[model samples]
Target: MIARLGDTEQTLDLPPGYTLVALRELGDAFAHAREIAAEAGAGTLVWVRRYDLVEFAVVLEPDEPLASARRAFFAGMNALADAIAAHCPPEREVAFDWPDAIRFDAGLLGGGRLAWPNDCAEDEVPSWLVFGVILRAAAMAHVPEVQAASGVSLLSEGFEMVETDAIIESFSRHLMTAFDRWKERGFEAIARDYLERLPQRKAGERRGIDVNGDLLVRLAAGNAAPERNSLVDALARASWYDPQARGPKFE
Candidate 1:
């Protein structure tokens, strides 16, 4: 019923078919999850207990080749955003900034990140992949005023007061649902849902996720060759994370 990693004390009431691995408040859930992903296998959820942030990562074993399996990140993002939206107060908007950062009502609200084996070839089926999430659940004092101006926490954005555990539980269910939809329908449905959540571009431009998960941006409606934004480059480092703070950046 309960699993602990070192000094981590929190307990999470996860949904069926999940394994909760709690980390210390000071632990890095994303990094640690990746370290043990190979042995932990799929459905292992690594979580960190922080008052102002809800951080967690889940290990996944995809049967598809690494090239296409990378698209699982899109499903993770869609599920994460949907989980948060489910708990948010009425009319609160949930959106993404490109491939990784999530925004709420246009305010930076943390986002998702993913990791896979560094040396795996594109065509090889990866042994494991990790999808991590970090969300600002409460206002913090150390967040810079200017950064805070550009970003927001659920508490500051007028969201209903909700428990971090509840969010994680909801996310687990949503993630399973996302994978189900991908299986029952196709990756096209997953791609459409994830792309729809991005900050919509200008009228003439269009956007999409390629088979390999690169973001394709078209500057004009017709006769325009879309520009490719490499997902590998984009995810090399998390855009929404602050290395100094070791958590989600306010901006």
Candidate 2:
């Protein structure tokens, strides 16, 4: 993969240990990364150069079992929202819908997806995990009032100066920072940062990722300890992805 900027396409400057693979405007960065992650190894960043969406994927080799490794997805999502917030114009609300959807000011702005080897078992350590990201940088058509009311693009949401390269670079940097914190502190650090950005939780309901990545929702009071949300189940299908169009679903 090769990255194309504007008129003259070039590789975006990535941090050390990161290999940049740039794809054409129409290439699917996520699919390609998923296909090649086993061989690509860690620190590989696959990016697609397109006008409308900033699409990319990263390869990671986790030191833990597949079950616990999936918790990294939460950290990745947190870093993504942080990267966007870093460049966001002041006071524009950014949040997550749950396990994996990102919204800005109550409008959809695309989200993330995770993939691993199909044969990998929960107890086994997979060869690699591919975390893919897509962000709507521009609206492809004339967004109707109703549709626009529920979704928005970066340009539509006051991000005129923001570009795909900048976001990707920022995400890589932030992801590194997030991982470092997780290593130094623990998953609690990642969970705290992520839960803080979650849209609206019922008051007194605290949420956190379990040892195996399942969502643990605990009430502040009552003997009602509710059932857990299986993170594996939630990530089995991308909630915000549109299978028919092979892109994000909005409205």
Candidate 3:
């Protein structure tokens, strides 16, 4: 992994077992990575050169079945959080909203996404998995006055000192740390890290993540039962992201 990725095309000489695929800002790293993942195999990082957002995707080859392996999303999310927090001013708040929205001081920063072979079955080994992430380093569009109160960017949040390449490099290293921790400590550890980053819930409210990565929230009412949000279904409908628009939305 590089501590700094130079602008030159040849600046990305990665370590063995890793393949580097660079794309112009116009390219979609996530879609491209997924398209090439089966042939590229693990450790393939598809990175796009963009200043407004640090967008990239990595190829993963999981040994576990798709159902159990979906937990990898937590690892990526945790690493993404760590990467952002590293540059955040002390005490500046950052948190997650359920499955995939990330917020900073209660304002949106960006989120993560997961993709696997469409034909993958719960019991079958996914041919490949791609973990994609985007972080707002600079605001590309003006938030409407009404929505401005709920939106944020790294620059506005006192993270203007952070550069896009630095975030991606930090993410790659932290992602490796997260994966190692998950491999040794199990998905429980990964889930705990992810949940800890979520916004504080109401008092007496309990939250837990399901085996398949759904969010389970329980209110402390009599006969209270956990309500489950289908992570797979929600993620499939639409990403919280808009590639063409170049940002996220409340939708």
104-128: candidate 3 lDDT, tens digit per residue: 8887788888999989899998988
Worst 10 residues of 2 by lDDT: 140-149
Superposed Cα deviation of residue 97, candidate 1 (Å): 0.4
What is the C-alpha lDDT profile of model 1 across 1-251, one tens digit per residue?
A: 48766654456777778888887778899999999999989999998877888899999999999999999999999999888888888888899887899898888888889999999999999999999988888765587667666668887777655556677888899999999999999999999999788876687677778889998888765776888989988887778888787667864
Reference-based TM-score of each model? 0.92, 0.92, 0.87
Looking at candidate 2, what is the lDDT of residue 66?
A: 95
Model 1 lDDT-worst window of ten: 1-10
- How far does residue 5 in candidate 1 sit from its true spot (Å)? 7.2
Per-residue lDDT over 77-140 for candidate 2, one digit per residue giving the tens place of the 0 to 100 score: 9889988988888988889877888988888788988999999999999999999999888765
How many collisions per candidate?
0, 4, 0
Superpose all Cα atoms of candidate 2 onto the true structure and report the RMSD in Å to 1 decimal: 2.5
Q: Give Cα distance to truth, residue 93, candidate 1, Å.
A: 0.4
